[model samples]
Target: IVYSWLFWYHSQLLTMKTEASVLVEVLDINDNSPVFENHPATVPVPEDHTVGDEVTSVNATDADSGFNGEVRYTLLGSAGRFSVDQETGVITLAAPLDRETQDEYRLVITAQDQGRPSHSATTTLDISVTDINDNAPIFSKQQYEATVSEHAEVRTNIIDIMATDKDDGENAIVTYHIVKQEPSSTPLAFTIDEESAH
Candidate 1:
């Protein structure tokens, strides 16, 4: 801005006069929008991970100064399973997760400034739920019954029992064991195949 004015000074014995113009500049405006930089597109979390654990972080920046440059973080579709720090942009787990029930989650993270007409930006986040050995193996049948003659051979096919687990990888692998029998026998009445459960 420029201003024009006239100034004069007079002394009792002498007279002097001066005139001058002045210019001023102003900076800073709420014109910049928040921008997300180098944030991950996808993240993986374990199903057995404890609640309130750190999942990941997001960052954003603005070119404006003061309150317009200050960014706040938020999660748009966390579904009560995740949360984000307003000032730090750190994401944390908010609830227990089960991969069997929900394998993945799609969310949007938002960054906004404090300007009068807040400027904001959004980023997509894909959170994949990794498998864990949290589910126990369940037997298809409660019990198995088989009858054999006293003169049966040493190796004989018996009733097959099966159990299933909802977990993945080695966690889903099921094996069989003969813990006990109804009546005690001198050399054990029957045997089972651990692999086939025969």
Candidate 2:
């Protein structure tokens, strides 16, 4: 919106008189929209990251003055998994994250001005959930039955047992250990390979 004003001035002298008009224009303060900087951002968060942790911050600027230039933030998507501060634009984790269930999330952040007809801008936030050692190894069967000959050699293979972990990277690496043995033999009658669980 613009307002225009006209001013008229008259000058009189002996035998001469002159008149002039001048025009001036004024612009409204709520004419500009909010703009985000460095939009379409991507952030990486560990799966074990605690809830209410600050992930990142978003910023915007408005050319208008007073309330029209004030910016507020809003977060969309992720089903309430995350939150953003309205005045600061700081994104925070609102719930626990599991990489096995969902590895990534797409969020839409909006910045709006406090004008009469508010103007808003949106940006995409790609949150990548990193791997962590949270899941334990789960065996395929609850119990195993194996029969071995009494005359078996010392290093003979007994049985192969396997377990898998849902985590990624080193967290998913499964190893085997012999915790107890039946009959309580003095020399340890059974053993398992650490790598192959045999």
Candidate 3:
């Protein structure tokens, strides 16, 4: 009876029972940007970490959901001495690191989002490594020697030698090269520091 009445009195009924549904839509917002939890992450690799040695990583995170959360890494500024994975964020040492020539390096890493006109974030890294004494010191003067006056003070400046190297890390270790002094030459004729004055 009620079904029949509802069908017959639909146009005339003022107060009656009715069923309705509601629909809502949501929009996306750029509430957050990519960030590096810890800036200046660092690591050390052998002067020669083989051909495929994973050096370090650049960790980045996004606060958005879905595709917006996807982050990609890029080695910006200068891709020298390192390479970063676009997907995994793994940074690998491409060339050998020489501490004698370049003991430290500062790199900038960028993280971009997947969204259109994707947002980006950048960070700086301070990479410091130890010397391995692997690189043979190069005699800047090639070959040169001098003799001081026999009456000169026992302690005197005999020679000032310089050296250079090309490596990615500490493996480019450095030391002094004296090549045996003459009988009259003092034992303290030459000296070298582990750190580059640069």
Candidate 4:
């Protein structure tokens, strides 16, 4: 460092400034929420509805920035039953629906943004599967049968059973299986139905 003396009038002196710089801070706002136009939207459809049939619609909003505000839709549960369009927020029925077999569906959906810290939101969707009598009856006791004694008391307890099928076709035919009490077993039984066992 060098100290030079200029025109020192009355022994008074002062200095001038030299360099400077600027800084900035960024903040985040509520940009997006994985939500639908309505919490639970409804779409009436026939059991034989086409694949392209529009099931329902949902929408998401983001206040961040371009593309950052862009949202994508995703169906989290029972996907084979329905689907969502990422851009249009439109949902379409993927397969046939039978309220008898599966009355209603509760779905989880997410909306996410393409950002550095990526933000997302989750929401539940209630889908009511309308009835169409499309589901055929299924036999729980496929190939099982029981022998009842001639003197057996009426309404005697038998066994428990159930059945299910993906299609509403005759493949859903109802039948039952009953393994009667053997020599090592106790009494015999009788009675059957598609609904229950006794």
Q: Please, what is the whole-model Cα lDDT of each candidate in the order they appear?
A: 0.86, 0.87, 0.66, 0.64
> In model 1, which residue pairs have backbone atoms overlapping below 3 Å?
none
TM per prediction: 0.78, 0.78, 0.56, 0.49
Question: Distance from true position, residue 63, model 4, in Å?
Answer: 0.6
Q: How many residue pairs clash per model?
A: 0, 0, 9, 9
lDDT of 3 by residue, 39-123 (tens): 4466655454553467778788998766777898888643377788899888777777766577767778889888776788999
* Model 3: how far residue 35 lies from native, Å: 1.5
| lDDT over C-alpha atoms for residue 196 of model 1 | 81
Model 2's C-alpha root-mean-square deviation from the true structure amounts to 4.2
In candidate 1, which residue ranges exceed 4 Å CA deviation?
1-24, 148-155
How should the candidates be ordered by lDDT, best one leading? Answer: 2, 1, 3, 4
- C-alpha RMSD by candidate, in order: 5.1, 4.2, 9.1, 14.5
Per-residue lDDT, model 1, residue 168, is 88
Candidate 2 vs. true structure, TM-score: 0.78
Displacement of residue 81 (Cα, Å) in model 4 is 0.9
Best by lDDT: 2
lDDT of 2 by residue, 48-120 (tens): 8889989888899998888999999999997778999999999999999989999999999899999999898
